[model samples]
Target: MSNTAGRIEPAITDIEQLKDHPAMARLLSWKRDAITEAKFDRDELTITIDRAFIRDACNILKPEFNFLSDVTSVDWLPSEPRFQVTYHLLSHKLKERVRLRVMLPGGQPTVESIISVWPAANFFEREIHDLMGIRFIGHPNMTRILMPDDWEGHPLRKDYPVEGYR
Candidate 1:
């Protein structure tokens, strides 16, 4: 395989200035429902979506802030409340990056798809669907992008058992 398969990722610190944008305030005002939390690294802003605000949040970020970079998710199952899906976005124009996280409860852990805002998110959303089982609403092709279609379970989930063999 060729070496250039991944998406373009800019410097993390480049987006340090994005907090000043008014959308951040508007996001915070969504009934205070948006879960804004501190990143482990201490210097980053990780906006956690409440599932309800997922699409609107992404919309405000892309066309407004120009941060249409990448979208993906993580599986934090077995942990209380379940998964933590994340979206990594960067703006070369503004030299800023912002990460959005959405915590899905154990039962129904799905969020709206962002493919309508950013076409590049199509494959990334599929990856999250394939690996974490977090369904993205409105994704044109919400099938598995990395793993096989008939795979038994989402391997990235913490509760998924690891195979003894390679």
Candidate 2:
């Protein structure tokens, strides 16, 4: 139904085949340990990881799959785990995507920094640490990026009640 190089032609399919890729297998098994639910879209895979697996998983993902993307966190109050950290990873060359997430309770929340794997994350990680109070151990420059260095508490924490919002 479309024009080709010289004559009318049909749209050819470009669905690349995916076989038994070990990275996927390992990721799936890891997800099973913590994920309550999971689903995979054609182009992206979203897996919820346990807090324990976060550091270890990112270590493997960055090097093995060349994943370089944003890492951010969200505050989910009234939820068992008070925080949700999201990692978005993509490989343009391979046209693949992986989204990894971790949940942390309010009392003591921390995750290892991935700066060693992705230099760009140095600042991003710091920002999350500063604003969300999710400690990132081993961060070369774990300083406040958005908030003042001496800020008392993490602004994004759910329990950080506003002045009038009882």
Candidate 3:
């Protein structure tokens, strides 16, 4: 798949082929099992880190991928691992970005907080918790950001009623 820049954007899934990538090389050198999957698509790299190692992965990549661009979640209700937490990181020095993801099961999804790595993650993590009900462990204030404190359910959840839960 070629993009507007005429760059060949092949969806490379093999970790071996992607090891040359700086992020991949750094992560692989730390712990191979920390990353479950790797993909290069649309000129971007996405690495799915194991839930237990998300915090460590962030710490390892912090020096180069210094900017924490965004933190968000997606709910895949019917899927066994029904939730995915995504972190977008940017490297101004290298002029590149890499996405890190962690998959969580349906009931009460939770992952360690990255606020220690990037304090900017504070609000982003709060918003995800408020709207998607995914908890960010160790977050100083995990209270609702966009939704009311008494909100019934995570409004952004796929199983959340369309008309709003009564």
Residue 164 lDDT, candidate 3, scale 0-100: 91
* Worst ten in a row by lDDT for model 3: 1-10
Per-residue lDDT value at 62 in model 2: 58
RMSD after Cα superposition, model 3: 3.1
TM-score of 1: 0.74
lDDT of 1 by residue, 69-139 (tens): 67766665567568777788776666767678877788867788877777888888888788778888888
The residue-by-residue lDDT of candidate 3 on 11-129, one tens digit each, is 99999999999899999999999999999998889999999999999999999999999999999879889999999999999999999999999987899999998999999999999
Deviation of model 2 at 130, angstroms: 1.0
TM-score rank order: 3, 1, 2
Please give me the total number of clashing residue pairs in predicted model 1. 2
Misplaced by over 4 Å in model 1 are 1-23, 29-32, 35-40, 164-166
lDDT of 2 by residue, 50-137 (tens): 7776777776665556766789999988877888888888766666677778878877788877777778778888888887888888
Give RMSD to native, each candidate.
8.0, 8.9, 3.1
CA lDDT of every candidate: 0.69, 0.70, 0.93
Clashing pairs in 1: 15-96, 15-97
Worst 10 residues of 2 by lDDT: 11-20
TM-score of each: 0.74, 0.71, 0.92
